[model samples]
Target: MATITAVVNLDLPGPTISRHVYGHFAEHLGRCIYGGFWVGEDSDVPNVRGIRRDVVDALRALGIPNLRWPGGCFADDYHWEDGIGPRDQRPRMVNSHWGDVVEDNSFGTHEFMDLCELLGADAYISGNIGSGSVREMSDWIEYLTRADDSPMATLRRANGRDEPWKVPFWGLGNEAWGCGGNLRVEQFASLARQYATYTRDHADNRVYRIAAGAHEDDYHWTETLMRSFDPLDRDDRPATPFQAVSLHYYTRTGSWAEKGKATEFSTDEWYLALSRASWMEELVARHSTVMDRYDPAKKVGLVVDEWGTWWDVEPGTNPGFLYQQNTLRDALVASVHLDAFHRHADRVVMANIAQTVNVLQAMILTDPESGALVLTPTYHVFEMNRGHHDAAALDVHLKGAPEKEVDGRTLGLVSASASTRGDSALVSLSNLDADTAHTVTLDLRGRDVVGHRARVLTAPELAAHNTASAPETVAPRDHDDVRLRDGRLEIDLPAHSYVTLELTLSPTPSQPLVPR
Candidate 1:
């Protein structure tokens, strides 16, 4: 096995990796909301107020910090009022965006809030801007956050929710350049300002309004949105029209018209998928540079609200549902993207993997026929890296790391990122090589390590996945091929694997230590 060297600068701590960076997304598309998270109050599956219990419990275990809801493309066409009041009395409409199915409005504002509560996650609601008016959006915010005897507040109470829900993260729209209405960047920016103006903060709930931003490397779109921020107010401070902007990206091996399969892929495609996911680092850096010119203080965050692997729908499934099987390849994609997020934690404040359950790169897949819930390989990555949430990012420098060429692009065979919290630190690593095991050595600096533990997630093949009957097919297992010797940490990382190391660090000494 080839050996690689890396350095973990324990003293050089960076920005706090926001817990929100490990966020999740649940769109109305596919079975993500209906059967995945919401199985109704009468279903045989154990649930709490119609929300799936198994799903919530599994996600809570990962410490999911926030959840973006309502839609991907479906948000723009969704009318909030239609989902309120009595479930049966609520208006039913055709969900034009996904599968052209009828939406009964059963899982609406209250239901979403309840789900968030159960998982102990913050609500990141995407508003309807494509077909709804400013008044409608304003009233919805009022109804959700208002505390006093206001008009919208009164209406909310009448609907059975006596107290308003706290909505911290509010989205202006989703993908305005496409499914969210084909408006120019300038037009969308203007609309964002107008709509955000009325999204008031009520009671103790302060909403962080996020405007729909660019798609992929649309630097111009981000520039336009940043330029549209309201000029300095009377106090000579920038007006808070929106706290952050959003960007959506997905790892697809082929064009939109022909996304590759979720399973049954060749080795070339595996490297291709990883190479594409690695591009997130470039995207974050480029976008952050643009934002730096406008907001030098970095007060504004870049929320990657929609991101993950998007493959062709499973066979016999509705194409619009976006249901795809998750594999070890998907887990590595998540690891690489998360490592990028950690490296750029200063700017990339929040990132939500698309369709958290039963849709594109889902954490859990529920069988509709058997009512069985299976945790995907990608889910293991999230659970393993939960320690990085709200932790100080540690700089990790690699040397002699292996690399491979894929489709005319260089693909790094090893990926690593580290973060320190309290007296413990987490180091997550991924081995992209399919057939080669690597021995990795880390030169730990600035702190004394008291102990260590490690785990590995990998399978014999890249296409290995979890199913209802065999949920542990691609799960994590305790790794014993790791040890801390002298000051260096050595780890034996197997091929097609994701590993995390938990290090117990001693407190900083008041004086410098002499050479032992």
Candidate 2:
């Protein structure tokens, strides 16, 4: 490992990290919608719309604030009407892209919005533009969100729900630059305008209409959306239809074709995974620059709905199913991503990581055969860092580095962020070096931290993970190893580990840190 800079400035103002940023996705592809979160209504597992009640309860326990349903690729072909009323009567469509499996429109509009209610989450719908049209998109929005007592509202009431869902977030399409349809911005922009025109405002609802946004680091696509928005309309009365511009990014350790699925990978592989995750900064900076040019008021929020590492799945699992193993490395990547989100909290209002349960760095995985469920390492990171959601972000200045060197590549260590909640202050720090642990000094200059103590979660190897038999392998522990002498707090970070320090200003000592 080479010596590098780990400088952090905790003085910049950042927006509140949306609780929705901890949101999840569920696509109809693979087991994500089937055996994963769904179990047939009477399989001795209990379900709603073939969705497991246990899964719903667990996600609610994790405080999942918002959920995106339908598809990444699957959303393009989904028809809302087919999924209502009777299950057996629903039409079966072919899932051409995913195992050529037949889709039994059993789980559709009403089912998804109902699940949102069960999970107590805000609903984010991805409209189909590639295969769906202005009318279909318009009607679906009307069916779910409109309360004007229209035909769609009557249809919804007949289907069992009397009130509209009032879903806050709605996407124009999914991956327009790729799976949704390889449409140029000029083409997508016109299509977006058409759809927004029909999917207009309804009652008791102020939908945050999200335009199908750019992929990673694609500045020009954001440019087109902003330019096409044309703040000044034909009547010069501000006519941009979109409330939020979106971005979709997925990280890969290596090209998917080069390597097959495996639980254990090389340090190089681990580094590659992390390096891809680190691009959150670049994606935001470049995209934000375009928004600055056209939408200078920062009125439209940035939404990154589909994200997370897309690694190979476990053996014998459907590759299209995307059932991959989760590890400590994934957890760390999650922590860093959350930190990045906190840093860029101003522009980025909401995001969801690809598919939730049983797919792509999932928070939880279930066993259909054994009726078992387990929380992945990625799950724990969200639990630990969830405190930052809706909290003000503070910038911290650091003077050191956790430099990493692998096969001619070098990167720094020591990433940090500070946030204050009410009277308590907290700092999240990560040692980004894979081989070298560093002693970090946190200068709490702005606020007066008198008799407070430090709490830490760390490990020496830094790549440690948890298994079913050994679930405590990567759990956080109290670091008595921390020292807070002279108001200048110092702590030791293990190689490539993450730690959260809560600074309390109580005159009395709280209990010793509990490592639960």
Candidate 3:
């Protein structure tokens, strides 16, 4: 084994992990909307209001700081009022776009806001901008958040809620490039100004409006939005109206339509999927560069509100709903993406995976027939990495060779990042190679290290999964450890494994190292 030394100079500075980055997204697509979160209040399984009790508890355990609701493609055509009123009285609409299913707006604003309350999370409402009027988008803000006197507020009070939910984070639109009207950035920026104008900000309500940005690496859209922010706004106020800029990214498989196989796939396919997730680094850098040019002092941060793998659903599910299996490989992808977000925490402030449950790489999967739920392998990674939330990103340098080559492209086997909370520090690492085990040394040279314990979340196979029958097969190990000495730690990482080490530092680690 090559003994590479990762000298993390404790004297330098590191970034601060954004709590919003550790967020979950729930969209009105497939079971992600119906079977995933909403299962009717009369079901045998535990439920609070319209949301699932088990799902709420699981999300709380993951320490999800923010939750984006009613989105993805679903946000484009979604009408807020359609999902309000009495569950029985609510008019049913054809979800003509997603899987051609009937969407009874029973789980609308009140339901989503109520669910966020249960999860102890901040609500990120994606406003209707495409094919919806400025009044429609603004009315939603009034109906859900406004207090005292307002037609929407009065309707809200009649619906049985006394006080406003006071939701802080609101997304202006979903995917403007694709499902969200397919307009040029210039056109969309103008429409955003009209929609944002209506989103009422009451005296007590502090709403942060995030304008729709590009999908993936379309920095031009970001550039356009940045340039047009002044022209598109009723008020050229960068502080309140344009609180944040939103971007969407989905980790694609080797292909777009058939996202390869979710679980059963080749190593080459694994590299193909992760290689795309690894591009988050560039996405943040390029988007931040654009934002820097427009708002040089870094006023607006890139909120990657929609992100996750888009693969073929498990066998025979609704194709349009984007339901895919989550595996150990998926967990590594989540880890790498989280690491990227942490590294770029300055600019990339927030992120939310596509759908939290029963859609794409969900943390929890519900078996409605059996009234059972299984936490996916990707969920375990989220649970382990929750330590990075709101914590200061510490310096971590890796001294390891590239894992392998996929179609002439090199793959990174060892992935690592550091975060600190007061005097305690945490280090997370992942080895994506399936065949060879690695004896890696983690050198925390700058930070004054003392004693630490490691927890490993790994699997014997890269294609390992956590089914309803065997949920614990790929769960995180709370007491796993690596051999650590003064300022140095050595770990034995098996092929296709992930670990998070909790180090109790002698002093608080704050100086971020300038990456060499």
lDDT of 3 by residue, 1-516 (tens): 544455555445567888889888888888886888887788777788767888888989998888887886778888888888888899888777788888878788888888888889999988888878888887888888778778988999999887988788888887888788888888888887777777768768878889988888898999888876563333445444567888887887756756678888887788887787788878888889988887776667789887877777788776877777888888989998988888888888888986799888898888857868899988888888877888888667766556566555566777788787777777788877777767777767556666667677777778888877888889887544466545356777767788887766656455432211
Q: Per-prediction TM-score, please?
A: 0.97, 0.91, 0.94
Candidate 2's C-alpha runs over 4 A off are 1-13, 46-50, 232-239, 259-262, 405-410, 450-464, 505-516
lDDT of 1: 0.91
lDDT of 2: 0.75
Q: Which candidate leads in TM-score?
A: 1
lDDT of 2 by residue, 1-516 (tens): 333223333334466667877889999978888777666676688777677888887788778999888887888988888788788899899887777889998778877887888898998988899899899989888888777679998998888888788788888987788888999888998898788778777876878888889888788888888887756424555656887888988777667584423357767777766776777877887788778776666777898888887777788887778777777777777777777777777788888987788888788777757767777767877766766767778876556464566435554456677776665666777776667767776666544454444444545444565555655666676666566545456677777677887765433344332221
The local lDDT score (0 to 100) that residue 231 gets in candidate 2 is 65
TM-score result, candidate 1: 0.97
Q: Any runs in candidate 1 off by more than 4 Å, and if so which?
A: 231-235, 508-516
lDDT of each: 0.91, 0.75, 0.79
Better of 1 and 2 by lDDT: 1
Q: How many pairs collide in each candidate, listed in order?
A: 0, 12, 8
**Tens-digit lDDT track of model 1 for 271-383:** 99999999898999999999988887788899999999999999999998899999999999999999999999999989999979898989999999999999999999999
Q: Which ten residues in a row have the lowest lDDT in candidate 3?
A: 507-516
RMSD of every prediction = 2.3, 3.6, 3.6
